[model samples]
Target: MASQAPSRVGKTLIALIKIGLYLFVLALVALVVAVSVAVSQLPSYQELVRRDDLGQMIRVRAADGSVIHSMGPSFGEWLSHDEIPAIMRDAMIAVEDRRFHYHPGVDPIGIARGIWVGWTRDDRVRGVSTIAQQLARNIFLTNDRSMGRKIREGILALALERRFSKEQVLELYLNRVYFGGGAYGIDAASRRFFGHSATELNAGQAAIIAGLVKAPSNYSPTADAEAARARANIVLQLMVREGAISEAQARAANPQQVEFVRTAERHNSARYFTDWVLPQLETLIDETVQPIDVWTTLDVGLQRAADEALNANAPSAQAQGALVSLDRDGAVRALVGGRDYVDSIYNRATQATRQPGSAFKLFVYLAALETGYTPTSTVVDEPVTINGWSPRNDNGRYQGPVSLRAALALSINTVAVRIAQDVGTRTVADMAQRFGITTRVDTNPSMALGTSEVRLIDLTRAYASVAQRGVAVVPYGIRRVTTADGTLLYQHRSDESRVLVAPWVAAQMTDLLQAAVMTGTGRAAQLGRPTAGKTGTTSSNKDGWFVGFSSGLTTGVWYGRDDNRALPGLAGGRAPARAFHQYMARAVANRPVENFEIEVALPDWQVEPDAESWYGAPDDYQLVDPDGNPIQPVEDGPPPPPQPREPGSATTEELNQEWLDHAIGRNRAPQAVPQERRGPPPDRGPPPRRQQQEVMPPLPGQRQSAPPVVRPTETPPPTIRPRAPGTAE
Candidate 1:
């Protein structure tokens, strides 16, 4: 019975052994099939060899090709195997894969370790990606974590090892990996961190650059100096252990002391310009396999100056600001979108659409100049109501006859509306659009006061046309675009037909604008040289602008609250003009002083008081004196008011003082009210005994009806003082 039991046990053991053998055979067959499938699906060798996705980077450079910034993936230039520094190669191999040279793109020991860890752990904590395997994954595969992906990566790695030399494989790995700061390869990483090519890298820099292969942003010196140095130390220690460098050499490396260059993009001032230029690139090149160099018209010096000026002055206005500077040919020199690039990147200079305020009056006045109206042509600066939109003068006062130059300098909204009504709003809008203002302007009377919304760049370009003697300007940032191999894709060519035949108008307008800067609202923009500009203050002080030009360049500055809230008391004469002055003073410091060309003046160019009558002012619109008497249209200033009083009372000054107590709060003087008029007793008399009354002087152009004086007893039905032109009030 014992012998029979032993036999039975032996049979059972033999059966179990046979089952295990069959299972092992089945598993081996599945593994072989998987490997075969992965190999068959390996990416084509041509795809690997023709890798040029790294060349799709767009590099934006100044006109002289000095790099301003770069965009897209793998912006660094590619390099060959021999060009890589020995120290750099050693550092990478020591830390990333010490058996790089010995392995056939897959290390058996590393694979075993990874498999054991992955099976026992909740998450795969080990990676056996060799340099060749990494290159395969980077170039041809996604970063998906799965058994299928791993098998494919391994197969591709093996194929790469068989197809290329170890040097070529390592070179591909080094040049294809991502480094921090938008750098892709060793060449770019070197230049990015050290401001020099990979060939110029030292042992310390090479170690730091190599350490980033593990995790670029995590150990980037620009992002985290401590983590980057600690990682570099690990690379150095590995190098020492691998015998690639002596212990003393590793200890003396001092990776922490590496002078990391500031590779952060410096497109602060040019952000708006670059953003505008990027879209324009599509017009020049549809597709390319290499980095395209875009030569832009940006002057870094001028850009720096503009940024500094805007930064220093913008905060004072409690608003964002945009400034665009263009050369005489409409080449954009500098553009600042807001106060700071870090706070916001909305590109206010190019993308923002805001009311230009009275700056648009330049177009209206320019249109008038085109139509035989000289700088001295008279226009009535009087109260005007158009379709329930009453525009008043800034001070709620009117001048019977103001020269076109003086009206513009004062930004008189009524005079601008009257002129637009006379010359036709469409004519002014057409002139504005013809000069480069692409914004749609309505033919409403308010459009004459800059109710139309336009971008700062487009408006500045329009002013550039005026500065350039009526030559139309297409404001452009890109000077030329070329491939890395210098194949020309686009180049700027000037066109002469853009010049207006009425060139004399620009010359005359320039004189008028110069008067504005020299003795008017833009006095803050004066540079002691011949300059011309206009100041614009919108309703509620929401937008303030100064668009001005020197013979060398024209600049437009806009200051406004981003939320459209009013910046009370802020005007173009204040912050905007100051910023313009500061920027222009520095921009043209080195250029030879120049002046606007003078066109021969006509006999009627001198201001005439009655000239405004030719514009068909309403017959009911009568000029009135401060005393509420009808005024004659005299060529000179209005005559002194008639003072009537009892004989031997007092001087005019004493009578004014005595009348202050009895003056009417509104309506008119008690005496000026006709005896036949019907109304309550005018409060022109002093308040009873202890009560003192105060009153404001009557507006010169306010028409009198009946006396309605305000007193302590009543509000006098609320006197309605007309709103100042362009004021929300």
Candidate 2:
């Protein structure tokens, strides 16, 4: 019996020893598991998503930490962790993974569940990616939906978990996700749909965002509104099944009238300004350089106003035009570069160098004012010829003894010619250049009548001088540039110069221009605010121009056909000034009303043309100084009138030869001369313009008869589609 007891004790001891060995092995395995979990939660993997320019975009708002616009180097924005809503967090996690909080960034149970569902449907496991895994796929892995790639994504996701915490992973995921409709993440997505930021979103909004994660392209808010709603319903259903939402609450959160804005669509908001600003980039940046953003001083409301007015008032002639607005400091506040960008990138405001016609008279008048001429200076208005060139008033009728102010206010051409004579034509040209006229100038005396070419942008900035106290300032578009990481790149600075005119001169000029709006051609541009402006009409009714300014804004408007065809005989007050006024009304609506300071020394001058009595004409009336000194008329004199050849006193060719010799100097001639010189001496070539410009006619003072000849090719390309019978001339 003692031998049996000893055997039992030995057996019991052996059993206890086996259990102790098993427990020791299990304890070792648990320690390895815990250490692996801890190792997988580092934050160093953030380097994968880093950008070099991130510093430039980090402008901590002086007012708050909130960033204004995309102040960083990256094209899109990154949302901060604190800024995200709790509901958003829950929705994403619930939709992507229910075990997200429990798992170490990878859920084996969810994977098993997905594999089972996919196997039942098709021999495939669609997904069961945890939120961390989804983020890893989006940020670090290619989005190829395949098993091999999925395995790689899983590996990378586990690696990501090992390098970053769950919270950090979630934040990165939110910032890097693509939410469709040109929106990259929740921030842009919120703005696109709700017209606000992500912070302002409610549950419905948050749910819509979560639903879009599966198929952002198909269910984007802007692409298919109804489809997006259907997608939201699916998300709501899922939430209810998961107890994240109640049935009643889901029913109440109907997405039925919810507007889905596709922020990706190119909204041609400031089309005219967009058109006008293209070529100006030549001075701002090189085309081969990096893609830089241009932050123009565009006033959204004013731009809308201009678009509305243009659409409401545009002529039926293919519907095209532009409006430009500048601030008191010469910053282009708003610009409608054209009616549409897709139609033609021709950027009429900066590229179309068309004739200003009577609008050209504004510069002529301004130059006169700057050079010993005043608003009251007397200028003769009549049909007169220098050499053989004669200029008539717009109506072919003259108003005698008109004051300089009245002559300019009414845009009388003959008086403007006389004023140009008083100030040298070259002087006028130089002054126009200083005012920002970059287009080709004809150097002809008719340049005073704006027969020379001019673009809308330079023309607008030239007129901006009057409102800016005679200081010629280059227009500034971008305020500054920043790096991708909120670091400083560059700030734009303007190179301002004082154009030839004095402040007081511009002040008085502004007064005259204001009077034009009050009672003359620019009456249409009259706003309730204190304002000043000028109206321009080109020859044959080819173009219309209105340039104006208030204390806060300066704007210019131009209307014409790209083919140079004439539209209706609507004067500057018709559409151009109306557009300027409309844009300015909105541009200055919220700004304080103030007056331009009259600070230049006033120079006294005498009365001018009322509309009659042509003065400073080639062979007509003379320009007398204040003390009755005869002043020589300066002009690009016209050619000699055609002489009736003695059956052939000279062939039309010889006639043009003689005319060209005297009209232009022997060194220069019109391109039109070659065809006429080849044809017979005909009566058809001399239009009213040619008639008024009778200077240096081949054989003037002799009237003779001849057969009429027409050259179809030489006929000016139907520049003016004149509607008004009398005005067509």
Candidate 3:
């Protein structure tokens, strides 16, 4: 019986031992899997922790070409502990970990004590960390304090202490920490927090800073004060327990003396400007290296002027709006993305896809002129509907049988819509597309009333083509980018190649736009200098836009909310226009006060007949004297015809009257004519036409319908232009 009992006990022991072995193997496998997943899930070190480099955009003065925004080496003027005061170091120790000097990085004894208190005594002191441990976490680990990461962090912390001395580690940690409000490093923190050198610190201020180290957000001066005070008191007690301070001394410390960075001025109205400028760098680099300097073209003085003007002008009796200022080549000089970017980062200028209102009439008029329709071509500005879309003028009343110039100047939506139908929205959109307008425009007849959504960037860029008289320079923010070591990374140069449209067509559009600003809704955007621009008010007063160009500067403004909520009393002619004028007036003050360079791009006509005369180009044209002397064509073919007129219509009377001044006899003015619409691509299913006649525009970048009127080749072209600066081009 005794022998049997001994064997039974041994069997039981063997079974329990096998079970323990199985559990250990399962735990090890689980740990390996978790480690693999964590490492894989982490972002690249360059993007998260080990990243030291951020490109600093360098802003240069347009006149002097001096770099401004930020100097190279964004870690500018950082100091070591020798340069930092001993009091500052002591303060950090006081707030963070009093035993920092006495212990290695791991502090296992403290951790053991923490476990006892947390598990047995039910106290929350489970985080038995030293300053080095905190630094290790900050520089390497994430804020997540999971058990697995904590184990890894301990291993890493021990390795770090072995590699670096206490002082070296402290210096790195101090120099790399962030203290709210976009500030990094102790030097910036001190300057921002105390408004003084790190060498100058009182006990109370030191205590306040020390308190912030525990839980930065919790003890942040920006958050709650009572919580910060309570945390600071806890840190004070720790200092006393560590013998670094007497109880009396700890009691003497109060947070009241911790004066915050005395100025809230750093985050001033420039947030919107910076937000707009930052995104222009996506294609500027291949891989992240040292900090790259991006020299911007913003004039800070002009930026401030623009911001001040917008706020004062927007509330005009009862309106809210936004503003943007740009250089002549379309480099945004200054922008109020919204009243405040934090209020909303959706930049109204670049992101808002709002209806352009009657401001779209500029494109209609330009299309007419490009197709040989003159400013004197008359149209009735009556209430009109196409399909089911009805459009009206700015005021409900329409002026009948008016010249193109009069209809555009008065911003008659019905007249513009009629003209768009005649010339085709495709034609106007094509002209606009050639001028750098990337928005997908609508082909509906209401498109003439600006039913299509347009971004301020595209609108301003398009307008710049008119100012350039033919060539449009695409708007760019960063002009040049260079590495921290002064190696050139990328540089942007303005391309002046003409994409489409003749210089004459640009001139005509400019002339019409000039008329709009000089005696229309855009009058508010008029700078005292020679300028041309247009004003746009969207539905329900949701967006107010003003875009214009001086002889040397072009700018645009739009005001709206991120929620797509209507802004009360907002209109293109009110605050947005006023801000436009304010920014341009100051922006161009330093520019040369000369008119924009303008010239007609005429195609050299030819009259040469091909072999067999199967197709001799009939485009041969010649210059003739008013007395009827013929000038030979550049290429020989056919004789110039007598002035041609549109078929019977009231527009003929206005056309002949305007052309009479330029022609000797039998003169005819250009008239707007309708273009055919191209249907959908072959093999694609067409939905019910009754459900949809034409597709509305998608988002900003998608393609819809191509503009009908293609660009003209070089030839004997007539030039049109906005006469002066105040002209509503």
lDDT of 3 by residue, 5-50 (tens): 9899999999999999898889778755654554455444234333
Give me the candidate number with maximum lDDT: 1
- TM-scores, all candidates, are 0.76, 0.64, 0.66
- Report the CA-based lDDT of candidate 2 relative to the real structure: 0.63
Q: In candidate 3, residue 383 scores what lDDT?
A: 50
- Model 1 — TM-score against the truth? 0.76
Give me candidate 3's TM-score against the actual structure.
0.66
Residue 558 error for model 3, in Å?
A: 3.6
Rank candidates by TM-score, best first: 1, 3, 2
Clashing pairs counted in every model: 2, 80, 34
Please write out the lDDT profile of model 2 over residues 1-729, one tens digit for every residue. 989998999999998898888888887576456546645643354453452312322221111222323322332445667779876776777677777768876788988988899889987777788777787677556778887877656666666666677777788777667787656578768876777788776767888888788888898877777887888777778778878878997787787856655442244635445444444555654332232444456656565676676666666557578776777676766666677666766667667787776666667777665543455545455543433456666667777657677777777776675566545577778878878888766555566777778888788887777777777767765554443343444556665555446555677688778778888788888888788888877766678888878866777788888877777665677888877776677777788989667435332211211111111224455645444565454455674555666773633333333443443344443453333212111223222222232122111211333112111122321111112111111
Model 2 quality (TM-score)? 0.64
